[model samples]
Target: MNVPAAPHSVQPVRLRISYRSPESLLQAFTKSVGKGGVSLPSQRPLARGTRFLFELTAEAVAHPVEVLGEVVDVRRSASGEYFLNIKYVPGRSRKGLDAALLKLFEAHRHEKSRRYPRVPVHLKAQGTTQVWSVRDLSRGGAGVELETGELPKDARLGVPVLLELQLDTGRLMLHGAAVWLTGGTSRPKTPPALGVEFGRLGLETLRALDRVLVLDGFPAGPWQAELTFGMDAVGRMP
Candidate 1:
């Protein structure tokens, strides 16, 4: 006879997420709705009926969208990843939330599809003792602006460098290699910029980067595809 699995214990959780823009918030909320409910990664499975308090905010919104939810399902993957499905409680703000979601959906319904290999961004990053401006970013690399005078004398293609980005959540340190440079003798007409391709990133670092990308309206499908490819490449490395 097969033994029954043990029941998960109840654990209350509270989470807060702030989006950079209203459009980003709409994307995330709609995606979650399509998945049946909000899904959050967890280290351990929570029992069904576990309560959750979520505070969602966006830069344009004056007030947070507070919602209470209960865990309706728990799932664990073969890779030991745990996730909880949270069903929202129909509170006083339910109608307003529904209306807002509908408005956002309608507004974007007619928008044309576009591809984003890199998204423009204004972010600060520190390398060694100098600060650089992050002008654009993609899953694989970043374009940073730095004056020719500021560029290190030893800076060249394939030179490894460490950059600490000031993300909204916190600072993220990344290892990268300079792939190209412009605005020097090679390309005098172009603005001074460095193309740095990131090295192998840890899971946490990838997740953090994902959060930033999502807020910047990066398409989820492409991001997921790239992430899977990266993971597969890492797995293949001896």
Candidate 2:
């Protein structure tokens, strides 16, 4: 038996959603959203009544807002795109989210959305032919993880390195400097990590980075974005 979906109103603001996948995270953008539901565009129509967890990204919000929902409706748009209507379910406390949203609707209505949204991506970082795992990325920099054997003890701060991102479109190479380091095999954390701040890149390289970021819900656009399961495409990551 099927239950009636809870009613909802359309919100003025739009948001991006990242759904959980067995491999990694898949992203989508909302056509319309509300306290009780949201409509998302999808290439593949999700199954009706299929429940899933997703993180919502909104303008000026520093962290991803968590939500749980089930697909209540699936319809094909006039333009041949698939629209999935999901009904929100209570999970985490929405007090903080509601407050932030209210502020966006009221006070900061004119605030511009972030031009460069950070994303959780796994890309390979190669410096001097040595490889590392770039776990998180933005247009400006990335957080890379280096294995115990790879972290050079003699390397000083601001050491220059090059990152080669194997994106679906093509290979993107950018130069950067090591701004910070943390973790190690014997250190407090599990794997060693480095914060690489990207230096100036060529016009083409910058465009490529922007393209990759857009695929990951950075500014939300139509792109060939999908989740990758193995780290081989993104370098060795634990």
Candidate 3:
């Protein structure tokens, strides 16, 4: 007797994938995706049953969709690329993620809004103090410019550090972890930068950030606090 195949739960989609873990955030592409599972081409394939979080960004989509997936199968492409099959795992987090994706779809139908209100400010980290330009501020995270060797050689993903910001309202203290770093190439000829996601934001501080984000007609989407970074070895911070 022959056995029947499992049913497909969700429609298949092809999306650009940004895999985030404590080690670093790397880019990849999906071959096929559905509510039940997804197939992606990856340079670093994980062992079967390994679970991780990633953001699916698409050209037509305004914001990336966050999903927690577990590796179920692995395959090799004709071009010698590794293809990993990932099954979606739903829990308390799935509901919020679904809602956020829906909101992004709605916002995409409207006029494009400003990225976020940013201003020049001097801030210090480590024992040495220096001025850094900050932007894309949210209750969850912000981006900071990093010149050559600006990031501590010892700094790694998910390492918490205290940062001081000089907002127009007043001075504020923030605790965040290094999530993503990019740049330092000939094309740009500019310094690289680090992406910091807030970990211990106070109630008052959140309100202050909300004013800066929502007041200017920026539609809120998923933030980094809901995800975890995994450790993957990468080159030095740029």
Candidate 4:
């Protein structure tokens, strides 16, 4: 008699999220899996299986979603970025996350109703406290429409800025850092504008950004976040 082979398991479904801090909303895509985690931050690695909390603010807070999860998988991507997978224990936390995302979506809906906002595509310099207007935004990046009066000295992607979306999206509250500037048909001297990639987003939050992109007249499609930086060896922040 022939022996039977083991059945193949399916990969868990990945939900996209757009999470907000006081400063900016982050767009991210991820799938939930397993338990416990480790961190690459300076001098400290979170104990494995430790539970952590992610608080969504503004629209995120208004909605029902909050990121409450336990780290399950901790590894580094090929490009050297730390990869963390988590499984959120459902209950009150799940509701919080849901609420937060709903609010952001509501904001997105309102924003789309009037005029589609534009994001700055490029910046010449990185001064303290940079800012810009979003011309059009998509899942991956936004084409920023810069104004002379509103030029960003420190224009960056991950940098904190007041961001909003219609529908149930949440308000960004915490950290935003510089990721990159874009590059178009380049002059001999000028490089492209900056590009930033978000590391974290709640599942519902990601959904709000997707809805906004579609409302902004982008054909509904999957968009991937892109970044240029890669760390070879994990190091402490201090």
Q: Indicate whether candidate 2 or candidate 3 has the larger TM-score.
A: 2
Model 3, C-alpha of 75: deviation from truth (Å): 70
Number of clashes in every candidate structure?
0, 0, 7, 87
TM-score for each candidate, following the candidate numbering: 0.40, 0.41, 0.35, 0.29
Q: Write the per-residue lDDT of candidate 2 for residues 202-235, one digit (tens) a residue.
A: 7888888876553321221111122111123233
Clashes, model 4: 87
Q: How many backbone clashes does candidate 3 have?
A: 7
Q: CA lDDT of each candidate? A: 0.57, 0.52, 0.46, 0.36
Task: Output the number of the lDDT-best candidate.
Answer: 1
Error of 1 at 164 (Å): 1.3
Better of 1 and 3 by lDDT: 1
- Order the candidates by TM-score, highest first — what do you get? 2, 1, 3, 4
Deviation (Å) of 113 in candidate 4: 8.2
- Model 3 agreement with the true structure over 1-238: per-residue lDDT tens digits: 1111222334222333543421111112111222246666776555776665556644444455555666688788888777777776653133433333344335545635634333222222322334344534556677666544454453456665445543446545666688877665633665667777777677897776665443221122111111112221112111
Residues 43-132, model 1: lDDT tens digits: 677778877756667764655655667788888988887877778654424443444444444555565652224544555444444546
lDDT score, residue 153, model 4?
41
Pairwise lDDT winner, candidates 1 and 4: 1
Worst 10 residues of 3 by lDDT: 22-31
